[model samples]
Every structure is written in C-alpha cells, then in structure tokens.
Target: MEKPWTKSVTLALEGPGKYVTISNTTEASWAMIEDWPLDDAPALNRALDICAAAVEGKRPAEDARKAFIEAAVEADIEIRE
Candidate 1:
C-alpha cells in the first residue's frame, strides 16, 4: 500500500543554493527549511532519504524525526530560540 503523505513532500532549491525547502503540500502541510552552507547539503540529503524510507514503510516516522533533528544539530541550524 502507498503512504498518504508521500505525494505531499516536495523539494525546492532556492537562489542558486541559497536555501532548500522540503514542504508537505497536504491539508496539514508542513515544511523544513535549510539555509545554504554547502556543507549542510549532506545533512539535508540524509534527512530526505530517511523521510523517503519512512514513506515507503522501510523506516518509522519517529526514526525519521530523530534523524532530521540530528541532521539539524550536526548542521548547526538554529531551528529554535
């Protein structure tokens, strides 16, 4: 079976690599924003990969969130004040 939210995820690379946005276009839409730092590209890629795996049922959503959070921490992306 297919995952409902799989189709809602989109990737937007901005301004010749100024930033990246991974958005969920569903009714309960949400997004993950990553600013350009070049080095952070791998972290973003890792998070996206985890999300894809979760959508495919190869991984759990909680695991995905953990991976994403770790990526953000490794990238030093200040997501909260």
Candidate 2:
C-alpha cells in the first residue's frame, strides 16, 4: 500500500471554487488517469510514472508531489498553496 504525503496538494478544477486535494500516491494516480482534463501530456505521463514508483516504494512521495504539480501546470490547472 502507498503512504500519504507530508502535505496534500490542493488544486482547483474547471469551475469556480471547485477543488480537489490529493494527499497520496494513490489519489494522485487516480486523478491523473481519471479526472484530468487533458487527454495526453508529457508532464502527466511523468507524474503517473512517478506516482507509481512512489506507491511501490521505489521513489519518494515528495517526488510524486512535485511531478503532480508539474502535470497540473502543464494541463493549465490551478494549484492552491
């Protein structure tokens, strides 16, 4: 099983005030695969790979978090601090 991150990544979706918080590798993986608005992107693919590695204990959760943020930016999604 995957462990939760030190801090959650909050992002705003398409609509105003709508938000989703991804707190772990699993949630990040799901969001990228299912909830992401873009069909395909380099950053998205990198995030998916990083998330998978993190879940398998091959990479740090922080790496996944950074990759997720990059993917969100590539998709033009708004990330909240």
Candidate 3:
C-alpha cells in the first residue's frame, strides 16, 4: 500500500458483479454492480455509466451511487452478504 491515497479504495470483481469502494482514513463503502450475461447486462452498463459520470464530474457522486443501488435492486444483485 505504497500509495496512501489508494488506501481507502477497494476494487473487487466477482462472477456476478464488479465492486468499487472509495473513502478516507481506511474506512470506505462498496458499490456492487451485478453482472448479467454479457449480451444483456443492462445493470453493468448502467453501473459503468454512473461510474464514468461520477468520475467525469458529469453527475454528483451520490447520484451515481443512487443509480447503482437502484440497478442492483432491480437486478436482485446481492451486494452485502
């Protein structure tokens, strides 16, 4: 963990989804985006869109987060186990 800035960031990928976590002081939260089949993973697309928007300053990070949560609920993706 040479990069102190990345200490609070967590990125994980699973068979069912991709995860992105960011925070400060080593405390963070994760957003899980469900990964449906490549041919029809609407959730993943929306998730990526939100991610891009949030990073690009096109949308508020919280709004982007809401989008992901909504998508996850719609897809019935299990985020927290």
> What tens-digit string does per-residue lDDT give for candidate 3 at 1-81?
311232233333343456545442112113342323233456656766776766666766665555555555565655543
lDDT of 3: 0.46
Point to the candidate with the largest lDDT. 2
Which prediction has more favorable TM-score, 2 or 3?
2
Q: What is the C-alpha RMSD of each candidate to the true structure, in Å?
A: 7.5, 1.3, 7.4
Q: Model 2, range 13-79, lDDT digits (tens) per residue?
A: 6554799888988999998888899878999999999989988889999999999999999998988
In model 2, the number of clashes is 0
Error of 1 at 68 (Å): 0.5
Candidate 1 Cα errors over 4 Å, as ranges: 1-40, 79-81
Q: How close is candidate 2 to the true structure, as a TM-score?
A: 0.91
Q: Give each model's whole-structure lDDT.
A: 0.47, 0.89, 0.46
Off by over 4 Å in 2: none
lDDT of candidate 1 over 1-81, digit per residue (tens): 333433222222233324433323111112334343344367666766776777666876665665565565565554431
Number of backbone collisions per candidate:
0, 0, 0
Residue 42 Cα positional deviation in candidate 1, in Å, after optimal superposition: 3.1
- What candidate 3 gets wrong by more than 4 Å, as runs, is 1-39, 79-81
